[model samples]
Target: MKFKITHVTTYLFDSEVFLEPHYLRFRPCQTSYVDVSDFITTIHPQPVGHKIVQDEDNNVVEFCWFEGMTTQLTIRAESVLQTKSYNPFNFLIYPQSFNTLPFQYNDLQKKLLFSALEQLPISKGLIDYALSILKRSNFNTISYLTNLIKHLHDDFSVEYRAEGAPFMPEETFQLKRGSCRDLSWMLIGILRQQGIAARFASGYYYFDMIAPAYELHAWVDVYLPGTGWFDLDPSHGIFTGNTHFPLASSAHYQHTMPVSGGIRGSANSKLNTQLIIKKL
Candidate 1:
């Protein structure tokens, strides 16, 4: 499938203000399954400087600095993408690892997955909650992971907040309701608690029912012993594949913000965004 994506964000301020260098993570990283082409970013109030660089996570980052004061700032990103049917389960079990969960990684793997395995302080409450879903004595690793995902999907209702930071894992667990980012973060914590190397992922979700439409979506990427990273979306209770296009995956969610910057002004501001993803 081929897709054309356009995302426009406009900020209206009551008074003119200087803008800081803005970081845009709108460009998708080229992968075996997805090819990105004809990408462009246009900024209103013309930026004085613009440069593109790759972050540590390999995401394409666009940096722009505005020189003059302006009352309105608009940023537009457009791209054409062609995606193939990437079977989530296509890879072989390299080095005879990743046949299942509870597997160990070699030295190279340890270095790469070091940060991902760093565990957070887990409360007894969380462990109890997790065990409630475990149920079976002979728990297969894959089955446990799958059940964990399905449990979150079926047990919680999503409360979509268009803006703001994600809720903490504890908050999401107690409330059982959160936005996509919140759920993804909580899932990462859960995976890490179980010694699974996981990270937060943000991207675009394309659905046929909403053709020509798109959404900023979040999910989790867990490291499979020999197969590398695989994406799993707790909100959808499925492995992300053809329908999901990842923009960034990092240990922190803030790292993948689509557009973020600071403006020096006391005036009130309003934001508006437009997104459209069309099949081509």
Candidate 2:
């Protein structure tokens, strides 16, 4: 499948701001599953200085500085590409090494992970839950992984919201709902606790939107010893094949945010944002 993506993010302030330094991880990367055929980014009130570099995790990072007094800023990214499709249920699951990886837990993520498992009422940690699920199945790893993916999809409701919105994994579990980011983070944390290497991914999804707009999105990719990384979107109830494009990934949410910055004058002033996404 081929898709065209347009993403525009604007920042508005109540008072004039002299300078703004920003870090952006909005550029999609070419990987085994997806290809970035064409892409471009434009900023309004043109930046005075800018530099692009690859981060330690190999994610493209763009740093920009603006001069002069400005109250509004906009950054736009557009792209065209083709994607591959894969069965959401068919994936590799390594159950034997569920207790060996070093698990460094994040405060928010740890809370969410344990909370989600607690809601399962399984009386077991994440690894035990995965093992129990696997033990009941006689299928191969692919089938087992697929079944787990499907279980999450059928069990939860999809919830979409803007970035910076506060949410707890336990809350989502109680409601039986969550956004892609929430689901991905909770799942990754649980998998990691079980000795699985899973990472959080941030990017855009190209498709007809029910809301008539596009937005930043999140998902997860878990590593299998022999098959490598496989993408999963528990919120969408879909297994990402070649269609899901990746922009950046990190062990936790703070690292995967598309943009992070601070304005000097904003201590007392309010900051507002407008984001627009479209398929070209």
Candidate 3:
């Protein structure tokens, strides 16, 4: 499948205010299954300095700094991509003992998965929620992870909040509804509680029904000893494959923000965004 994507974001301020350096994480990292045929970006109020660099997580990002004041800032990017079908369950788990619940990672795996495995305090409700799913999966590692996303999808109301950090895991679980990021964060929490390493992923999901109108999507990426990093989209109740195009990822959700910066003055601002994904 092939896709063309355009994303535009604009901030209108009541008064001109100096713009600080901004970071943009809009470039998709090419993988074995996905190819970027072309990509370009345009920024209004051209910056005095601009450079592109790769972050620790291998995300190609743009850093821009401006010289003059402006009342509006707009960033637009377009990309052409071609993707191949991916089999999410094509791998085998090494070390048979690690295929069940309550299993431990080897020494090196633990060191590499340090941050991905870290978790805040877990409430009983969240634990019980995960345990209930495990009972149905009979504690099988692969089955448990797959079942978790389906339960979250069937049990929660997926809504759109346009902006804000995701709610804490406990909060989302209790509320029973949240945006894509909230669902991703909640899944991260549950994975950590079960001794699995998971991270936050932000990207675009190509759903035919939502064509020509869409929003950035968020999902979870968990690491298994043998299967490696795998994407599970709780919002969609399925494992991700060719339909998912990941732009950037981080153990923390804030780091995966598509656009982030600060303002120099106290000007009231309004934001508007436009996104369109089309099949060619």
Candidate 4:
């Protein structure tokens, strides 16, 4: 399937402000199952200089520098891409040791996935919550993960918030209601606490013949020795495949933001975003 995507972000300030260098991570990437073409980004109050570079996590980043003061800023990004359908379950066999809970990683794998395995403080209730859906005695890695995804999908009510930082994992767990980002973060923390290597992913997702739902999405990738990285979306209760186009994957959600920069001004700003994705 081929698609064209348009995303626009605008910031209106109360007063003129000097814009600083900004980094954008919104560009689509070419993957084995996805091909990107005809990508473009337009910025208002034209920037003085710009460059494209790949970041540490391999995300394509566009850096732009501005020249003068402006009361408004707008960034528009457009892209065309083709995605090939594939089975989400086409994962390589995982290492035998990682097939069960309380699993241990080999030395080399441990060193490589250290950050993903870092322990974060989570409540006992959270641990119990994760355990409730698992079959401890007859544990299977794939089954456990699928069950967890289904549990979240079936139990949590989806709440769409137009603006705000995501709720902390603990808060989301306690409330059992959250936005997509909140759920992704909660899943990451839970998997990390369980000694599994999981990271946050941000990107675009669309189903065939579906109406164009325009917004950024969040999901996760778990690192299993043989499987490499397995993408999962608890928000949709499905394994991520051709429909998911990842722009960035990181150990934290903040690092996956599409735009990051600042303005020098005492004035407050209002943000507006618009997105359109259509099949071609």
Clashes of each: 0, 2, 0, 0
Query: How does candidate 2 fare on TM-score?
Result: 0.77
Write the residue-wise lDDT of candidate 3 on 1-280 in tens digits: 8888999989999998999999998887798789999998899989889999887777899999998899999999899999988899998887888798878998898998898899956699999999999999999998998899999999999999998899998899889999999989999998898888999999999887833568999999988877888899999899998879899988888889998898899899999999888888
Q: What are the models' TM-scores?
A: 0.91, 0.77, 0.96, 0.95
**What lDDT tens digits, residue by residue, belong to model 2 across residues 1-280?**
6677777777776787865688887788887556778888898778889899887666788889988887877778777876665454454434444222333344554554442223221224444645665655543455455566676678878777765632445455556677888777666655554545677788876666587665677888766543556677776666775556788886656677777777767534443444454444
lDDT of 1 at 269: 90
What's the TM for model 4?
0.95
Model 3: how far residue 27 lies from native, Å: 0.8
What candidate 4 gets wrong by more than 4 Å, as runs, is 208-211
Decreasing TM-score order of the candidates = 3, 4, 1, 2
Per-residue lDDT value at 170 in model 1: 87
Which residue pairs show collisions in model 4? none
Cα error of candidate 2 at position 30, Å: 0.7
lDDT of 1: 0.82
Candidates 1 and 4 compared by lDDT, better number: 4
Model 4 Cα lDDT, one tens digit per residue, 1-280: 8988899999999999999899898898688788897899999988999999887677889999999899999999998998887877776666677777869888988988887787767789988888776664367788889989888888888777767666878999889899888888888888898889998898888775455556788899898878888788988888888878888887766778888899898989999999888889
What overall lDDT goes with each candidate model? Answer: 0.82, 0.65, 0.90, 0.85
Q: When superposed on Cα atoms, how far off is each prediction in RMSD? A: 2.1, 6.2, 1.3, 1.7
Give model 3's TM-score versus the native structure.
0.96
Q: Tens-digit lDDT track for model 1 on 1-280?
A: 8999898988899998999899888887787899997799889989999999887877888888988889999888898999987888676556564555556777887788887777766567876776666555234556677788888899878766788887878888889899999888888887788777898888888887734545688999888755678888999888888868888888778888888789887878998888888888
The clash tally of candidate 1 reads 0
